[model samples]
Structure formats: C-alpha cells, structure tokens
Target: MYNALQSYTSYPFAHLVFGEGGDRKTLNFDHRINILQIQGLKVPNQKKKPQDYSEIEALSKALLTPITAYTDQFSRMDNSLFKIIGWDEAWAPLSSDIGEATMDSGIREGRSRNTSFALASQNPTDIKGELMNNIGNKFIFNLDDPVQIDRALEILKLEKNEKNRENMTLLGNGECFFRDIYGRVGRLQFDPLFQELMNVFSTTPPSEEDTEAIHQAIQAHTEVMV
Candidate 1:
C-alpha cells in the first residue's frame, strides 16, 4: 500500500491525505506527502493527543471541502478533479461520527465531483453496515478463520457450498477473488514484477529511522565540502 501510494505521487494533480495509523513519519514524511497524523493533534495542556471528537471533525470537514467545491463548479465535467482517495485501514474512521458522515456522503455524491474512494480493511465486518452494502467492488483474500470466512461469504452473498468455502481458505499469496459492481467474479494473480517492486519498497520503522539518519549525514557532509 505504501509503495503504491508513493508511485501515485508521481502523477500530476494527485493529492494524498493519509489518516492516523499510517506510517507518516517514515514513508509520507520522507517522501513529503501530505499526511493527517493524529498524533500531531495535541491537546493544549494535556500531554497526550486530543481525546475529543473535534480533531476528526475538523479533518472530516477538510476532506469534504474539495469535493463540495468540485461538485459546485464542475459537476458537468466528465473527469474528476481528484481521481482517488485511498483509505487504508479505513474501518477506524468509518466507525467514527465524522467518518460515517464523510464516507456516506462521499460514496453517494463524490462521483459528481469526479472523486472515488478506495477502502481497505482487515475484516469485512469492521466496515459500517451501509458502507459495506454500497461497496461496488470487493477483493477476497485467503482466510483460514471460519468466522471471517463466513462474514466474507455473507457479504459477497455467495452460496454456502463446501467448494466455495474451501476455495476461500486456499487462496495463495498475491491471489484473490475479484468481484466487480456488475457481479463479475474471477480469480486474479498479480504480476510477479509488481509484487517484487512492492517487496523492494516495503519499509519498517527502524529501517526508516536508519535511512533518515543516513540521509541527514550525507546532507551534512555535502554541506561541509561545499
């Protein structure tokens, strides 16, 4: 997901606003992508981040502004001003008061503004009921857990046949069952080159910190020589 977002930044007019729990410090900060780091929303006197709903509310308002503006000014246009808003681990905000309102509105009305949302979550049940119902596309990965598999099957409205359930459990890495809004379903294997690129760009916190330190050291050395 991180690598994919990084690649997207290369496109013109593409704006990325990542939410909390994203690796803002590493990937986003290093790449200079705009991030909404919840940790930065500190309370005036308190030592911890803001506990009230205000922060998220502000974020929700900010997110809707562009869509609203685009809708008003360019509703007749065929293309969207902002192409995509990728929501990683979307369940967290989707369950919130502001998140529910923003997501609902975006899903229903964002198309006029030429915007679409891409949501990702570990469990289908974690998504809001309405949002889950309205999702046009779905990708089902391997799930060994009976409870999760049952939930996925229910969401997909798949017949509870033994063969279908077994197939869900046996999906290999980089393999997924793809379903489109029109009810088309098929198995897809991602390209090997794409998977290799993702693996190469994947980074953890410790590695990010070390990389940043090295970067700063190189900058300092270059400055001294200059």
Candidate 2:
C-alpha cells in the first residue's frame, strides 16, 4: 500500500496506520510516519505492553477520536476530505467492545464523510455479525486451515460446497478470490509494478537467532512490567 502511493508528491487522500508498533521498518514510504503509542501518545520505538481493561479503553478512544473529529468536520460531500485509516495486527482491537463500536460507527458513518477503514487480520472468524455486513469488499487469500477457509467463504457469502473449498485453497501467494462492493466475484493476482514493493510487503521471517533475541527481549520487558 505504501509503495503504491510513494510516487505522489502530494497525496490525493490522507492515510493513517493504526497498529501496535513493529511497522517502522516496512511502512517507510513517506516521512509522515508517526509512531504514537496509545498512552500519552508517546513517540518511542519499543514494543507496546499488553493492555488490560483500562488501557483497552484508552487505546479504543485514541483510535476513535480522529474518526469522530473527521466526521464532524464534514459539512457536505463536495467539501469533505478523503482519508483511509488502516488497522494492522488488529486482533486486540477487533476483540475490544469499544474498539468494535468505534469501527461500527466508522463503517456506518464514514461513507458520506469520505472515510474508509482498512482492517488486516490473519483470522477471518474475527470478522463477524455487523462488522461482516459493513465489509463491501473481501480478498480471500490462501488458507491452509479448513476453519479459516470456511470463515472466508462465509465472509464471501458463498455457499459451503466442495468446489468453493477447493478454489480457495488453490489460491497461490499474491492471488486472491476477490468480491467487490457490487457483489461481483472473480480471481485476481497481485503483480507489483516495481520490484521494490516485494521487499516492502514481504513477510519472510528473519533468522532463528534474531527471532529468539527479539522474543527474549519482549519477555524481559514483560517481566520488568510485572
């Protein structure tokens, strides 16, 4: 996403990424990246501590404030500004009642206000009920798990059948079963125009030692907090 927009000197739309840190390396398309931790909106390069109930509310409000502010400023469709607010590593936010409420309000009210929400999650089951209704487009990527495939189909509003199941699993890397806002369904492959984007979007893991070192660091931090 960042690579696609990097060429524009002046962005046509505003983009804000909401995540629990760790995107600093990959999200460097522009100098506007602000790593604001939920508490006091600190700009530090550290892994965030796990949130309890009170902290969850803080994080939820922090995310919802901008949406509310932007929506309130929209007097007319012509005068409204376009913005895309994305939530990466959305597990905790999706689980929170207040977070879900924030998203619910944003998804419902954002259309007229020219605000769009992008949520990235590995598990499709997390998207349920009213949240599922508001999602106009779905990109069903490769899934090795039957449970995830089932949920993906459910999100696609496709019938539970053998053919659909096979088709979903058949999707390779950068390929997806796309269902658009108009309910049109088709298969699509993501071909990056520039080779640099491959590096920007790659999920390839680091060496085992590097992984272990990072894990140990987080564990030590958690112990200190405890």
Candidate 3:
C-alpha cells in the first residue's frame, strides 16, 4: 500500500529538504555569513598588503567566485555580473601586455545555496564509505523478495504517521520491488537531498508534477530501504 503522506524527519525525506550532507556550511566562510549579498558579485583588494581601510573596504565590496585567483583588469559591474562587466578594459590591456592579471574576476554559481540545501540532511547508516563520488548514485530495487520488501516498508512505516496504514501497505510492496531489483547494485547518487525530497514527495498524493519529481528524485539517489 502507498501512503499519501509521511513524517519527514528521516531519510529520503530529510535527504530531500536538506540534501544529504548533514552539513550546514556549504558556502565559503566569508560568504556563508552574508550569502544574499554576494552571489554574482566580485571585488578585488589591493596587493597582499592590507595597508589600511581601503583594502578592507575593497575586500568587503568584492565577492567570491568559482575561481579563486583573478587577473588585473577585472570588474563586477557598474552593477553588473562579475564576468560580464568589464572585459577589454581589464583583461586585454593587462593580460595581453604583462601576461599577468591586474584584476581577476569570476562569478560564483548562485544556485550553490540550493545545492547545499539539497545535501544538508542525510543518513549516515544508509551511506557507504568509498563511494563519496556523489550523493546521488543510481540503483534499482528488486521488490519481488518478501524480506527485502519488508525492510523498505519498515523504512516507510517508520517515517509515516500512524493513521496511514492503508497507504503504507499500498506502496510497501512496490518499494520493495524497486529497492531489491533496481536499487541493490549501488548507492543512489547525485545530491543526497533528492532521496529525502522524494520520501516527502511520495506521500503527497501522486500528481503529474509530484510523480515526475519522484521519478527524478529516485533516479538521482542511492536507495537503501532500512
């Protein structure tokens, strides 16, 4: 039986909302405190020497990007994106001449915050070592086996409310079928949060949007029924 809804404190469920990391500081140290202010911005300070307040202000004004080091001729914008603001004025004159950068520039992936959230919560027991390749690994469950099916059901049961016995029974078998057959080979990987999201999503009355999200989530995560 498939449950229409379940408690979201555990796996596949927790994995979805917080992702799989159980980690909170996904963003860099400086930006983490002020994430909203620095997604697509950049500011370059003076040389290594922090002679005075201007350098501190420059450091504060610019933002961190995917690439750490920036060249001489660089800019964030008049209010522009870090990469698109001032290309020729900075990069060419400097890069073409001394082959050294006077100004360096780049942009951080804005969605990094979203990515971190997707992997913030995870099941350490469900997680295996040596396969840290990614949180979302793919494996199909083979539910034909009764024992394994029970295990998967147990996971669902533990996470569901007491009132939803009917739904639990409904999807329990199918959950088993999926885990044993397709999911046994390896851990579902991508972002661990995908599983958690699906665990929550699966119980929300399978609609067109939800079903698609479930399928995608399932495809993206490594599955372990317990």
Candidate 4:
C-alpha cells in the first residue's frame, strides 16, 4: 500500500502519508512526498520542525487542515484533481472525535474532489460504524482469529456463513476478498508489473547494499525510458 501511494510522487499528484518510526524512512527521501509521523502526535511546522502536542483535537487539525487547503488548491482546476491521503495503523486516529470527521469528510466528498484515502489497519472491526458506512470499497485480508473474522464479516454486512469464514481464513498474503465501489464482492490478488518496486516497497529494513542495488535499477530503468 505504501509503495502504491509512493508511485504518485513521480507524477503531479499530491500524496500525504501518516505513519510512524522506521517505516517513515522508506517514504521520506523523495522531496515531493510529505510524511506525518503519528508518534507523540507531533506535526511538522512551516519550517519542517515537529511541534509536540498531546491533545486529541490536534490529530484532526493536523490532518484535515492540509487536506482542506489542498482540495481548495486543486479543486479549482478545469479537470478533476487527483490526490491520495494515506494513514497507516489507522485505528488509533480514527477513534478520535475529529479524526473520524476528517476521514468522513474525505470519503464523503472524495468523488467531486478526485481524492482517494488509502487507510490501512489489521482489523476492520476496529473501525467505527459511521466511518465504515461512508467507505464504498473494502478489502478483507487474511484473519487467523475466528472472533475477529465474525466481527469483521458483521461490520462488512456479509453473511456469517461457514464458506465466507473459511475463505477469509485461508487467504494467502497479497490476496484479499474485495468489495468494489459498486458493492460487488470477489477475490483479488496484487501483482506489481515493475519488479524493481518490490525492493523499494518492501516493509523490511533495507541494507546499504540493497539500497544501492535498487537505486541503480531505478536509474537504469529511467535511462531506458529516456
């Protein structure tokens, strides 16, 4: 998911990532990308210095303020404006009063503004009913726990049948049971067309050697394109 959003950096779209820790390093190198580290609820100021704050309201302010600004900037274009706002480990932030509102606003008005929210979390049930109701598409990945599966299915409004439970538990990595915008449900697999992206998008910590190799591969690929 991080890699998919990172791809937009090469284009004209605006992408903002809200995540934490070592994961930030993978997406931070590019000047076009903006990352909001969620730890301590610290937000970057105008000078790029993080100001630490503990208020719950701060979360919504940090996230929605910029999005509102960006929407105003791009929504004026003759054509639709395309933008992506991603939040990793989403459950925590979504629980807050204004955090959910921010998400709700994005999902509700996304179509007209041409914005996409890439929110990710381990369990779908952790998300609130109101926020989930606003989302049109859903991707259910593997769940080993039967309790979580039941709850997730209930929230998704799918039948709590054996077949559905079995299918979700049996899913392999990179595979998910998807509900599209039109509410059609089916299985889906993600296969990246570009092989070099696997290295760049990997969740594992990249060694110095691996970093150099991927950089060279991307350089070579870009050269070929030119």
| Model 4 segments more than 4 A misplaced | 1-32, 39-79, 204-226
Q: Which pairs of residues have clashing backbones in candidate 1?
A: 80-114
TM-score per model over all chains = 0.57, 0.60, 0.15, 0.60
TM-score, model 2 to reference: 0.60
Q: Write the per-residue lDDT of candidate 2 for residues 1-226, one digit (tens) a residue.
A: 7654353213212234333356454333233332323322211112433353353344444554564344333322342466666666555456654456667777887787576777777888877767878987888788878999988888887998989999988898899988899988889999999987986677887789978998999999999999
Q: Write the per-residue lDDT of candidate 3 for residues 1-226, one digit (tens) a residue.
A: 1232233223221222233455464533223232222222223323423355353233333222222223212222122322222222222122121212222112122122122111111122232222212323222233334444444444332333433333334443224212231234322333335676767645456679977987888877745432
**Predictions: Cα RMSD each:** 11.4, 13.7, 24.4, 11.1
lDDT winner among the candidates? 4
TM-score, cand. 4 vs. native: 0.60
Candidate number that wins on TM-score, 1 or 4: 4
RMSD of 3: 24.4
For candidate 2, give the lDDT: 0.64
Give the distance in Å from residue 210's predicted Cα in candidate 1 to where it truly belongs.
14
Off by over 4 Å in 3: 1-112, 116-142, 158-226
Residues 93-145 of candidate 4 have per-residue lDDT tens digits of 56544456667777787777687777899887767787787887888899979
Is 2 or 3 the stronger prediction by TM-score? Answer: 2
* Lowest lDDT 10-residue stretch of candidate 2: 37-46
Backbone atom clashes (below 3 Å) for every candidate: 1, 0, 59, 0
